[model samples]
Target: MSANANTTTLWRPTGPVELDLVRALDRRAWPPRLPDQPIFYPVLNEDYAIRIARDWNVKHSGAGFVTRFEVDTAFLARYPVRQVGGETILELWVPAQELDEFNAHIVGRIEVVHEFR
Candidate 1:
């Protein structure tokens, strides 16, 4: 996940797994900084994605029901500035199982909202 250049310590995990995870999230990074908080949007974005994923993971971690997600495409095309110069304010989330695969192909299904029963 990312934070404001000012308030965020810019802390990120290091490793093949972590690197891919960050890159995937980079695709949806928000460009505008909230007037007050450093992580106002990015954190919220990541949290939303993660919360959904965590739930899916716990419910289906062993069953392989986890899926990928990305920002609403219409939201991006309507306001291209949301992605300012390709800078992302969105954070991506995935099960550790798919982390390695993402390193090679960042452009693919990001998260599955849910798996079918």
Candidate 2:
């Protein structure tokens, strides 16, 4: 879906297992985090997502994917942007408990924009 002022685009780098769970949800929402995962981090740029998918997820899981989606800008305001590394390495750290609410703010289906194996 096309993004407008009310929505912000976000990208997620996911492994095969997580990608399958997203598919099982009809591409509309992310699955609940595993017990050890307390945060759901969606990166702010495609390049960062691509870096993680290609360099991290692929090596760890044998495959990786970058998915893009839009979320309500207002809803996203609750979380501050986090810079984990270089200036372009930005992310939104949504608490795992809030994922269902976050999912409700998604504007459209999550689309897989890149993949590596």
Q: Write the per-residue lDDT of candidate 1 for residues 4-98, one digit (tens) a residue.
A: 22222111112233224444666322122224423312222433434434454345542222233333332223212233223444443333443
Go through the candidates in order and give each one's C-alpha lDDT.
0.32, 0.96
Question: What's the distance in Å from true for residue 16, model 2?
Answer: 0.6
Highest TM-score model number = 2
- Candidate 1 lands at a TM-score of 0.22
- Cα distance off (Å), candidate 2, residue 61: 0.7
Please give, for residues 69-96, the per-residue lDDT of candidate 2 as tens digits. Answer: 9999999999999999999999999999
Indicate the TM-score of model 2.
Answer: 0.97
C-alpha-based local distance difference test score of model 2: 0.96
- Candidate 1: C-alpha lDDT: 0.32
